[model samples]
Structures are given as structure tokens and as C-alpha cells.
Target chain A: MKGSSPLVRPGAPGRAGGPDTTRQAGHRATGTGSRRAARSERLAPYVLVAPAVLIILGLRLYPLILGVNFSFTGDGDRNGMVVGLDNYLELADDPLFRTALGNVGLLVLLLPVAVAIPGLLATFIYLRVPGHRVFRSVYFFPAVLSPVIVGSIFNLMLAFDGPLNTVLGTIGIGPVDWLGDPGVTMFTVVGVHVWATFGMALVVFLAGFSTLDSSLLDAAQMDGASLARTIWHVVIPSLSRTIAFVLVTTMIGMLTSMFGLLYVMTSGGPEGSTYLPEYYIWIQQGQMNRPALASAASTVLFLIMLVVGLAQVGLLRRAGRQD
Target chain B: MKQRTLWSAVLVAGLTVSGCGSATRTAPSPAGSGTSSKLVVWDWKSGDATAASYIEKAKADFAKKHPDVTVEFVAQPFDQYYTLLGTAIQSSTGPDVMLFNGGGQLRDRVDALLPIDEYVAEDRQRLAGWDAFSKDGKVYAAPVTLQGHPIYYNKEVYEKAGLDPAKPPATWDELMTDCAAVKKAGKSCFALGNKEGFGIQFFLSGLGSGVLTPQEYDDWIAGKRDWTSPHVKQIFTLWKDVNDKGYNNPGANSTAMFNDSWAIFQSGKAANVIGLMSDIGHWKDFGEFLPPDKIGVMPAPVVTDGATPSLAYDGGIGYGVAKWTKDPKLAADLVRSLTSTEALTAFYAKAGAIASDTTIDASQSGPAAGAIVSAIKGGKPALHVALSSKTLDLMGRVSQKLLSGSLTVDKAMDQMAAADKAS
Candidate 1:
């Protein structure tokens, strides 16, 4: 009936059509509206990401760039003229820098073993072992105390006339100078570092364990899998992500957090045996008036962290793929 | 999503705004007019009870003199003092006057200090030891206090150890013999805590002055003289001798100077303390421990066999007006007033400090002050102030190593030579 009504008018050769033109205009309007909507949709994710990107650029990237630039320049005195890689070259030959790097390397190598003990404890607790709650809390208590307090307390405990020596005397063992001897100083510092930090790692491990699939565990148990086998094949693999996170973060913390302990306990002495990179940096910048050297050392540290981080990311991605 | 975007924008804006605000706040600005009502002073040591009284008196006196001005005193703790001073000076929020120790540390910060030579020139005769204030021919700090480290012993402990209480050691050999007697008496001979490594300096400097000529000492400091030479070896040997003889506290290597040594000496478990200006008052309860008459003060024993050269360690504390101070003239005036004889005498009497002014009558000093004055006048260098901080810190570590038996005299001397060369 509508077609019959419209059929009365036929257009001349050059005249414009009505219904067809109307349909085309409607399509154009709808296309423009959809394009606007699509543009906003594309922008929404970027708008969400912009603040984070800006923050990273400001706090991390900018300081890193500035540090790198300052490292190549002369010491920040009135005569702080740019000297182009002199500081880095000096760092290459610097004995103190070598010592600092060696100490930091030692810390990194020792940290994983140190952290594993706490990780095992957490795993035990996560499996609902007897008295798990009390054990977990007991293990995690150290993490709540500040490093300075821990260091001071340890200083008193390990002092020459303190309880440690008294215990040794009673055991018919000779007195040992825990902090004074070069051989024992690093071990002392590392022991304190592990004690102060292991709790946080345990907490992370527990959190990771809670997310594991109980169904998989039960299935493994039904198949007559042993406890060790279930942990090895099921639990550890599930918590690989968390383990990587803790490993990198703890390594960074160990490199930096020794300052408070060293300052409180040794002041980097009994012959600079406990001097780490951060403490060395403090001496350079604050005590020695050698900020250029400190900056150079800082640059080396940045590079080390960068390499370690990249390696960690690569390993984690490969592990993720395997999973 | 729109609400999230708005909130995120607000957060970013907040951070940026705060950052800008702090940046602006931290930047330096020019001084206000002289007619300003308030004056600020920063001091670390002078905030102690005795020093506070003197400061209060000075404030009252200054206020009475200048009715238009109000004085404010801020005492920063020793640990945070330098940091706050550095930041404040850099930002021009510094006090009109600041207390400083005259040493290499002060020399390093010489650029931050305002030269007071002009003020001193106007009141030249009023100053004492004018050279103490000068750095690079410009007086930047005004001397306030003189310090010295003397060996103080418990006379009863000496008598108990079969050494004469009235006659302290006159030579290094005699001192060693006395130390042995004290040790044999089942008492700690000396309170030598190397944790802070300050005790090491006192020992080294005392020995070094006796053994090395002034020229030789200068050459050694300048790295021109070999630290592996006989003089250096002798100094370390003396240290080793003392350590090996059980003269020092048994656990000296691990003992903290501030915490452990004070307790040891106060408890009369130790015979002697090579104590600074502060240690005299530490024995305020002298009657309970040793009786007032039993506390004997003498020069740190000399190494030279004959009459002991009047050897002592003199450390000076002073005031410097920050370069960034808004009121330079007022700061200079404050420094002048603080260093004046009238001000210093009162400060010394009140604070138990040895007067830095050589012109001041030593007879006028209290018993403790008299000892410090005599020590300084007799030609002693405050080894802590004489050597650079790095050198001092190295000495500290080496001394610890020496006590621990990890570093022999030969090895320590070699290390010192190497360190001196490096520095």
C-alpha cells in the first residue's frame, strides 16, 4: 500500500531523489556517531594508563637519567663541569668500588638460600601442620621490628661480654669476635639481614599458597602421591610467580637495607669488613666529600639492578610459558 | 569510567601541585630588612643544661641591650645538626648564627660560611686567638670553646695496683708499667673503646707528637713522608704494646666509646680514661665512686723518656654565620657577641668549657678548665681537628684491626702508607 502511494511521482533525469537520499543521509549520521563512540572507547584505556606512566617517568625514569648524567660529570662542587665518562672510568679502577661490588654479589648469592628457609616454613604452615598459626606468627615477628632496633639488639647480644660469649665460655669454647674479625663480620651482617627479612618472604609465600588449587592436591593424593611429590609437582610450580617476586624484591632490599644495621652495629668497621655499597656511598657523599665517586658507584648499581631485573623478567616469562 | 578519569586527574593534579609547592618553598630568597623583630641561632653542643643557662643569660643580656630584637635558640641534635644546617643554608632558611667545630669538616663547608673579618677588624683587640677563626685569610667562624683530652685516673685504683697514686706516669714506659700493675690487680687498665675509634686518635696523636718532629708530621700528613717509616712504626708499636699488655679493656675492640667506656669508668672497673672535656662532669657523683680527692688529672703520658713535653689535644668549637643567612650583619653581630671575652668567660663558667681565648687567665678557670687551658698553652694539637676526617676514620679502623691482631705494626704502617698515598 505504501509503494502504491509513492509511485505517482517519477523524477526527471537531473532531479534529486527523496527516499534514497534520506536513507544515505541517515547512514552517514549513524557512521559519524559510531566513529565518535569508537574513538572514545580507544581513548579510555590510555586515559586509565596515563597517570601510572607519568608517575613512573617522574619518579623512576627521570631520576635514573639524572643520575646517569651526573655520573659522567665532575663532582658537584662549584667546579662541577661535565667531564664525560671520567667518573665511570675511575670507578672501573677503584678498589673500594670493587670491594662494594664483591660484597653486594656475596649478599645476592646468600639471599636465596636464606629466604628458602622461611619459604619452607611458610609451606609447612600452609599445609596446616600442627601449631601452624603460632609458628607462623613467631617466624613473622622479626619482620615487624625496624632494622635499627634489630641491629642494636643484636649488637648487645653479640657484644664481647654479652650472653653469646658467656654461652661459649660455658660450653668450653673460646670467645669469638663476631664483629671485630674480618672473616666473621660479613657473616654476622648477613645473618642479621636474613633474620630481619625472612618473615616478609614467609608472608608472601603463605599468600601465594592460599591461592593454590585444593582439587589438584586432592587428586594427587588420591593417586597415592607422597607429600614431597605433591609439594614438588603441584605446590612449588603454582607459586613460581610469587617466588620470583620475592626473590627480586628481597635481593634489592638486601643490597640497600644493610645501611641501618651496619651504621648501628659496626659503622662499617673492624677494618671496613662490613662495608657494603650503600654504606660506601654514604661515606663517599657525606663523610669523604666525594659525591662524584658516589654518583659513579650509584650508576654501576643502577646497571647491576637493570641487568638483574631483565634476567628475572626473562626467566619468569619462560616459566610462565612452561606453566 | 568518567568518575574514575576525574578522580585520576584530581590525584595527578594534587601531586603536581604539591611538588611545585615544595619546590617553591625550598628555593632561596633574599634577606628581609634589619628592622625585623626576631633573631635565630643554631647550636648543637650549647643546648645542654649548662650551655642553655648561659644562652638564656646571653639572650637576656642581648635583649636588654637591644630592646627591639627577640632571640630564638634552636639546638639540633648532633646527628641531624649538619644535615639541617646544610639544607637550611642552601635554602636560605638558616639561623643568623650557627655553632661549628673547627676542623677539616668546617674547612669543607667554608664556602657556606659568611666571613666575619670585617666585624673582627672593628673589634680586633676584643678577640682571642684570632687565628683560630681564620680560614684562607678570612675569619669565618668565631671561637667559643677550647677542648682537650687528658688522662684522668682513679687514684685508689692506682694505689691498689701498687702504683703511687700521687705520682702518675711521667713517661710512656712508666705508663706501661703502671698499666701492667693495674691489669695484674684484676682491673681494666684503660677504657679504650675503639667502636667509635676516637680513643685510637687520642693514643696515636699522643704518641705521634712525642716521636715525630713537627716538620715530619706535616710531611706525613701531606703524603711526603713514608708512613712505613720508623716514626709510623713506632706509633703502631706503642698501640700494639698497650693492646697486648692487657692495658686496654679486654673487649676493647667491640666496646662502644659512648655507651660502654663511660659505664666502665664510672663503675671504677677501669683505672684510667683518656677523656675529653665532657668526661670531667661525668664524675659528678665522684664521692660515691672514687672520692673527689681520688680523681687525678694529668697530661696523657709522653713517649719521650725525659720530662714529658706539655702534650695535649686541643679541639675548638666556634660559630659561623651561614652564607645564606638573611641577616648577615645581625649574624655577624651575634657571632661577635658570642665570642667576646665577656660572653666566652660566662659561657666557660656556665658550660664547663675551656676558654678558646688564649688571653684569658688560666687561673680563672675551674679545675677541669685549668687542666685544658694548661694543655693547650703548652702546645698540643687536637688530632681530630688536625687530620682530615678520612685519615681519622682510617686510623680508627686500623686501630681496631691492630687491637684484633689482624694488623701488626708493620702491616698497619704499610696500610697507612698506602691509604695516605691514595688519599
Candidate 2:
């Protein structure tokens, strides 16, 4: 989305303040009689921005520093002691923490699948596939439910003797241990997380579609472009910015917000294969009473999010520009 | 309550002054207990419907002695109770009195609790689980209820399998044969749930008495455990073997013990379940689904010759005075009232808690209760309770691995031993 200019847009045509008109106004406003007015006007933007700047510093930046500081300390008998890097050392030694990091890597690899599911659905809806109106509402219904509710409902449906398996068994397929198998649990949890969150991304795509050039679609149809070719040549290039935004937010959501699903669905168990950094931090801080170690995990998780997110946005931007 | 608080303040103050206090910073309030007269109590049970009458009775008991003091009970969700308490302790701002589970859970945080030994001295003979609430000979909490794992069999299931419910199996081989019969009858032998890895804990402790010899049982609790011992290894082997043999309900790994596993046994989907003796998941609970007569207590079948089967029990839930309390004596008095004979009797009657007060009558509940009550006299501490929180957590994960075939019993035992040693 592009930022809107209510008052001044520098190079746009027929705006209230043209560049030539602004120069004449600036000369009159800075004259001897209006010097005080000009000075205060110069300070207005900073005045408008002060509250948000202060809030971000206090709530956001301060906590990050506090957490990083805590990560260096010790827990339990050594509470409040500066046993530098001891907590981080212990975090490294923990197999569960390693599993959490591995899970993060897995999520990164699966990021495109998560993005594509909603992207493809929105595309179909935009093209007005049969029952598209009903499909749009129905497909997005699960996303309205909280992750806790989604996880619980899935708990029943994905059980060994659950409905999903019962359906599979009719065709002699399986009674898969969906949440218990180490190999399957992570995917199951990620799938549920996406199931419960895809609607938000779908809404974003729909809004992007509203701004899409419909004439291009008609022109493509007038030519001989296939549906796949049309999407690749026309739709993809036009919606690149929205896709980039969705990718960053979805990756962030997967890394930080899957804690609830992991907690409710598996408790990071079935051999801790479903462990994510957020869940691991919770176990360390909450269950194990090792606040320092939890802080260390939190720091690592934050770094992981930062590095992955920035790289993704930059890559997306370069891709968008090239297109 | 005021007078007792003054006495306790002086006593604890003297200890701190002499530099022998367990926690020195939580000094008595200078304005006295008057400023902090509103005594807040935190627990996970007060919100539970079954425990409502019990909390009310305890509150009434406390009110009689200190009507001037206001008592506020905060019911915390059980899953997040410890984490919330940990946060409060870190901030040095929390309830005056709080509930604690016994053994490693209490032992781990005993430093944050005021020793109520002197305050609770009068009730020593009445309560039986002091060891669980005590650390290094100093009692930090007063026991309110006893929790134990007791193997409960469905008499109807046994009868349907053509085995006389009156004459249940008494040995491992007999149990296996009976399980085969039950299996053939289209019901799993056990309704096991290991979702939280708690099923394995229940399995180990419930059957441990019949797996370990008398000397081995006592030795394990005394910090002389031999995890590599064949008998110890057998417990894990049975855990793996039973699941492998299809003796448990399907999806045991995903099924929760609190309700799902119990539901199977309640609906007669399984023959037996290693159930608890207090709170939820007990005889009282199972009785609600199946007729009380159908729910029968059975000691674990003898796994090895000379292995004595006994009930595995310990202090279930207890109330402790927080170090930050304005009135340790007042909080301790509340603990005493919570565990008082009259209060506990109401608790046992209404909530089906095996009240810490032994004087509370148990016969009225039923035959299963009678058997459990009789067995309590000979019961030993549960095998799992001896484990530290860290070790128990490791065991939970490894036990899951064992079930999933990723890990072997011997390797699991080695990991458990390593965690135990680190603890």
C-alpha cells in the first residue's frame, strides 16, 4: 500500500500545493511579521511524533535490552548473579532448545507453502470461481477462531481414531498418530496454525485484487494466455508488494505466535519434536523456573526473527523492483 | 490471629537478626499485620466445582478465629499456577498464603515459603504427609489432601471377559493372560494416556510396588536408586511392552489422563486404568460414570517374586505461608484451619478428597474407598515423587520416545540416570 498525502504530494499533478506555489507561500510565511509562526510550524512535526517515539523507546526498546541483559545472568541458586553467558551455555546444551531452533528452520522452508495456499485461494475467488462468495466466507471461517480453539478441534479430528483417520480407514489408508509421531507433529501444528490464520492473508490479497488492473486480465483473455500464465505474467507482478508484506508478517506469526498451538496441541511433546523457541522459552521460564535460561532463548528467538524477517523483506523488495 | 502474628514476627525476626533465617529480606511489616489484614490465598482448587464446599468449609473454619481479617481466595488455572507463582515470587509481591503440590515442586521453592512448623505443631499427629511438605527437616507447608495412584478395574469388563471379577489376577503372567482375554473381548486391557507423559509416571508408581522388592523401594527413595537394576528397567520395559502389545486404548500418546483415558474406562472401552485416589481421576470420579460397584480397586499384580504390592501415596495438595506475607502466623493459622479435622471431614465428604486428616471417615464413600483407606496404612511414597522436577521432565520425554520406538528402554534408563545424577 502506498502512503497517502493529505496536504502535500511533491511531484503529483493538480494538487493543492504545486512546487511553484509552495515557493511563493514559503517566502511570505517566513517574513519578519510571521517569523515566530514559521519557527513553531517548523517544530510541529516533531511535536506530533514525540508520544510515539517515547512509547516505542520505553515499551519496545527497553524490554529488549532488559531481556538481553537477563540472558547473560544465572538462574536458580545463582539468581541475580552475573554469571555471564552461563544461561546461554545451558540453552546450547539443552536438546529441547536445539529442537526448537530446528523447528524454526523447518518453518522457514515451509514459508512459501503457507503463503501460496492463501494466494491461490484469493486468486480463484478474484476470478469468481463457482460459489466463490460462499467459498470465501467458508474458507475464512476457521481463521476467525482463536488458535486455542483451532488446536482443540484439530485435536479430536486428528486423533488416532479420530474422524480424519476414520475417513482414511474407509479406503484402507491409515490411523495416523498425527500429533504423536515426531516426524508428523510439527507439520500438523504448522498446518493448523496456517489453517487458523490464512483468512487474514486472504483478506489482504482480496484488497490487493481490488486494486489490480482488470483491463490486463481482459487483454490476457483476448490473447491466448493460460490461467497459470496470466497469473505469472500479470497478477504476480502487480501484487508483489502485498505478497512481500504477507510473507514478512506470516513468517513473524509462525515464529512467535505458534506458541499457543504448540502449547494446546502437543505441549512440545511426542519426543519434543514439536518444540518451537517460544514454547521452549515458556517451559524454561514457566515450568523449569529458569528465568535466565528462558531469557536466553527469547533473545535467540528475537535474533532469529530479525535476521529472517529483514532478509525476506529485502529479497522481496529486490524481486518487486526487478519485475 | 493478631497475637499469633506478633509471636511469629518476633520468632522469625530473632532468627533473621541472628542470621539463620531461610529468607532474610521478607522482614515482618513495621505497621504490623493490621496494615495487611486482607489475607489473599491463591490456589487452583477453589475454582473447581467439587472443591467448592471444601474451600467454603476451610474459609468458615478460619473466620471463626479471625473475623476481623478478610480472606480473599484467588483461583489460578492449574496449568499456569506455578508459572504465575514464580512471577509473583520474583516481583516480591504476591498472596500471603498459596497452595503448593508436594515433593519436588514444594522442595524446589521452599526457600520462598515461611516455615510453619511451630504454628502447625498441634496438628502433627493428625496429618500423615509431613515429609512431602518438608525440606531439610523444616516444614514449609501443611498437608490438606493425599494423592495416590491406585489400579482400578472395571468388574463388568472382567466379567464380560469371562474372568471372575471377584478373583482378579495376582501375578504378571495371570495379568497377561487376563489382558489377552480382555483383548479378545474387544476391549483394551488398560485405558492409558501419555499425552502429558503423566501416564508413564502413573504406570511406574502404580505398578512399582509390585515391580520393586521391599528393599529396592525404600532404597530408591533414600537417594540410592539403581536405574540400571533389572527391576527398575522392568518398569520401563512393561511401559513399552504393554503399548507394543496393544493393551492400551488407541492413540494413548495423544489421549489425556485427566478425562480422555478415564472416559474410555467409564464407557467400558477398556478393562482397567491406573487411576488416582484423590481429586479428579479417582474412584469417586469413575463412580460417577460407572456404578460404584463396578469400579474396584486392585493392587498391581506381582511383577517379580517377593515384590510386595502396596498403595503409592504422598501429600497431594498443601497450603504454605509465603515469605512475603505480612502475617506468617495468621497465614499459618489459615493453613491449620484448612487442614483441621472438621474442615477436612467436610472436604472428604463433599469433594471425595482423601483428606490429610486421617480422622475423617472414609467408609461412607464406598468399598473402593474402604480398600484404599486400609491400604494407605501400608502405602509408601510414590516412586515418581522422589524424582526432582528436572529428572521427571526428562523421563516424560524419554518415555514418549520409548513409546514411539525412537528410544530403547536401556537408553531411556541411562538418560534418566544422568538427569537424576545432575539433579
Best by TM-score: 2
DockQ per candidate: 0.23, 0.29
Residue A201 lDDT, candidate 1, scale 0-100: 90
Please report the candidate that would top DockQ against the real structure: 2
Docking class of 2: acceptable
Question: What does chain B score (TM) in every candidate?
Answer: 0.81, 0.86
Task: Estimate, for each residue in B308-331, the C-alpha lDDT of model 2 and write its tens digit.
Answer: 999999999999999978777888
For residues B1-423, write the lDDT of model 1, one tens digit per residue.
112222444565465455444433533344454564666677786668777656765666676656777666767778756756665655555576778876665776777788888776766554434444566678878777755566678887888999888888877778878888898899988887788677787676545666665666656534466676676677778888777977788777778877677667767788988666532433332334555566777665666444335444443688888786666777677676676666666666666556666566645433434555656656555444556666777888888878878777787777666665555
Number of the top lDDT candidate:
2
Error of 1 at B181 (Å): 1.1
Residue pairs in collision within model 2: none
Window of ten residues with lowest summed lDDT in model 1 chain B: B1-10
How do the predictions measure up, each by TM-score? 0.81, 0.86
A-chain TM-score of every model: 0.76, 0.82
- What do the candidate models score in CA lDDT, each in turn? 0.70, 0.83
